[model samples]
Target: MRQKAIPALETLMSAARTIGNPYLERAKKAGRKIVGVLYDEVPEEIISAAGAVPVLLRGTGSDGTELADPYFRELTCGYTRHTFNEILNGKWDFLDGAVIYNSCDHMRRIYDNWVRRPVSPVYSFIYAPKKGGELARRFYAEQIRDFLHRTEERFCVTLNEERLGAAIRLHNEKRRLQRELYAMQKGRRIALTGTELLLVMMAGKSLPVEDYNALLRKLIASLKSCAETFEPGVRLLYMGAHADEPLFFETLESEGGQIVVDSTGFGEQSCELDVREDADPFEALVSYYFEETPAVPRKFGTAPARAGHLLRLVKDYAVDGVIVTRLTMCDLWAFEQYMLRPVLEKQGIPSLELETDYILQNRGQLATRIQAFVESIRSSRGS
Candidate 1:
């Protein structure tokens, strides 16, 4: 069936495509605090509970790293450099405060650079544990408590139990809706393209949960009624790096590859699980973020869990192969890709890992490689 015009999708794309978003501007004008989320694991619900919008900052539309070069240097990952460049260029001026956690070295550098010349009022940094255990979980809960205290103080809003619970429910609904969207793509004939899904996910990151949920409902309804079938393509699970742009997916899909599932920042990885509304909000959030949610490679002793998560996705979505794309100079994801090769191979799955920059500087070459990967996957499947 032919896809009908869904205005919600266009609205979402507009939100995803630019740092300047209408919903955010409206909220700012209405005196709503905008908290910039620099890392994936930082709980958005806490920001929402503090009566702020948790805007997941993206480094798209980067002209060059010229301005941020001196500040971050060439050693940092391109995602960090480009995003720091955007912050320097005043693109992120709308942020009242931003949460930066030490999820990786790049994030730690971002916090340091931001401190050199802080853009927003709150340049808060939180510590996330790299391992999991009873002690680790308890320690992480304390860290979350400190963050909540800071957020409440910064925003001058009391995040009482009621408000925190409400926020958890709101974000949980958003995750549920996103899962609904993904379920639409699990079939052989998909409704939305990978680029389209990324745009939608990006929209969720920017807008208020209430507004995002509404727009998402409209888009989902339209899709349920009439989502166009995708053409013959290789089903893929895209992993590694901090990929938030549609261009990366566009490059992958250009060669008969469809990214049906992804484990990248600002994508499904952040919203893979929901916090428990029944338990203490902070404890539930800590558990969800530290223990339940998909851990990035920086988290030690999590390779098996992370790999198992990917393997399940491959089976659930009927993925033909996995393409691990890491931004250049990202030591964490680089190691992650190397470690995942054996895991995927053990399951008889073919994989490819490409090192590209934040803006995909090596597009022409990357496209050639992606084409080859898709063709090889198809050949092996005898499709």
Candidate 2:
């Protein structure tokens, strides 16, 4: 089932690196609406069932936050700052609507500032619970149902059970293919560098489900023949926070480390679980995000579960070490690192923690630390 020298990775990554690709343009041109989503937990299957493209938005195209600086406080992390910059510049003007979630304090600023803008998408807010329990599950399901009704009424589409089932199956397939793509790296040689994989992951979310699934099928089947190249180094599990730019992963590759696996945003966290095909679609969606997937640090009482998840990944993937990176001002992930450090150490996993901004202006400094960490891992393992 493998093909020779398939030539689609570059095309897919090119589309991923930018905001709107030809596929996105084509979708818009066809009168299909694009709905922007800020969090991966935002139940995109519902968006698709409502006949819209659920774009996981990022600020890669932002040049500066001059447009954003005046409206926000200094403590808002660089991630949201650049996104606000892009918003003011009209990069995301293509969205017909947007679904915002209460991801953190920094992200809450998005809904507030975005509402005041004259030009913005019709909005729907999601309140994903920070805890796991039956009461929390009931509340989230009700919220999703409310979201569904708002989407249908706002977007003028009917979401029947059949449509919901179809959407769930399509997204579940995308999940399976994405996980399969990640599994391609479990061996000694990796098909692509961590940077390329980040772009691939980014690309997967940028396009429609069908198109992305096709690209993944081709890439997985023909990885040996893909045109891209990379050198594998110590296998490290890159962890924590939302970073859209490939510069972070590119730097890791340059420092003699291939992020063979990661727990970072747009990494393993997005694809580790799939919704049930047999259950009520809404209940399945609630269960998948609220219960099945490992709770992140932001979720209440999840530290032990998160630590166990990391430990299992290291053992499962043969990770040489772990690197925990977070934005300079992200309170949650800052605490996540502080809490998880002891767990990683108690297990004897060599690790590095870096505090960075969205701009990555301190690459030289971060790279120095990474070089030492890589050497330390090699020395300990006698590699």
| Residues 1-383, model 1: lDDT tens digits | 12466799889988988887889889999999888887667888999988889887668788788998987656888888888899889898878888888888876887887876733555567888887789988877887888888898898888888998999999999999998988887888877888888889888887988999999999888888773668547888888777766777789888878888777767787677788989988778887888787767878898888888888888998988899978888888878888998998889998999998888667789899999999998898798
Model 2 residue 325 lDDT score: 86
Per-residue lDDT of candidate 2, residues 95-202 (tens digit): 999988888878878888898788768578888888888999899888888899999987888998888999999988988988987887787777766777778888
Instruction: For candidate 1, give the lDDT.
Output: 0.83
lDDT of candidates 1 onward, in order: 0.83, 0.83
TM-score of 1: 0.96
TM-score of each: 0.96, 0.95
In candidate 2, where is summed lDDT lowest over 10 consecutive residues? 1-10
